[model samples]
Target: MRVVILFGSEMGTAETVADSVADALSAHDVSVYDMSDFAVDDLDVHDFHVIVCSTYGDGDLPTGAEPFFDELDACAPDLSGLRFAVFGLGDSIYGDTFNRGGEIAAEKLVARGAIQVGEHARHDASTEIRPKEMARDWAATLPVPALTSA
Candidate 1:
């Protein structure tokens, strides 16, 4: 089972958390990609995808992810056989649209036929909860697929 981890970060905190999650998932043979460096076309070949993104000003996607999100929305790839999970990092201080980017990404993925495996993980940096912990826990809960011999 090959899993693709896609992430977007603004101030590097989210990126750090994403890296930790990727490192953990690597033990299970999952591949990871920082959305900034990953091509949108690559998503079509993945069996499963994990999106880890941070919500920026006014619920906006990080600068590095804006173009990717635009292309994703335009192409709207069909992910019928894909299973996905979403982890959102944001500040509750934003109030009205806290973690909105992650929510939108998850919703869009669902609309494109991806099945959500578990509840969306929302982490608030402004609060006492640590985003890294939330990401690690979420990674552990994902069902590991049997290894196939190449």
Candidate 2:
């Protein structure tokens, strides 16, 4: 079983949370990618994907995430074989746009025919507790076949 943790962070919380998620997974193969370094072309290579992203200024995708989406749009790759899930980091003060970045990412993947494997997660930066721990717990609950031992 293999999994990929692809994250987009502005101030870096999402990356740290990615580490926690990787740590929590008992699977034998776990790969982590900073969105800045992730090649959108690689989407075809991984069948199981996890996205953790923070919404940036004015409810936008974080700096690291924009390129992937841009490339994905330009290429229009078929993603029906993929399975994915998302974790969103944002402050509720933004109201309707809160966590919009992750939502958009999820929407794009689904539109490309990827199967979503679990309930999506939205973490409020407003919360007193850090999102890392909660994110690990949330990711653990994904109905991902890759997370199970073969």
Candidate that scores best on lDDT: 2
Count clashing residue pairs per candidate: 0, 0
Worst 10 residues of 1 by lDDT: 141-150
Scored against the true structure, residue 7 in model 1 reaches a CA lDDT of 84
- Model 1 scores a C-alpha lDDT of 0.78
- Residue 103, model 2, lDDT: 92
Q: How high is each candidate's TM-score?
A: 0.87, 0.93
- Per-residue error for 57 in candidate 1, Å, reads 0.8
| lDDT of the candidates, in the order given | 0.78, 0.85
Q: Model 2, which residues run further than 4 Å from truth?
A: none
**Residues 1-150, candidate 1, lDDT per residue (tens digit)?**
677788888887667777777876776556767787886677753566788889988998877667777887888887687788888888888898999978887887778887877668888888887778778887877664533444
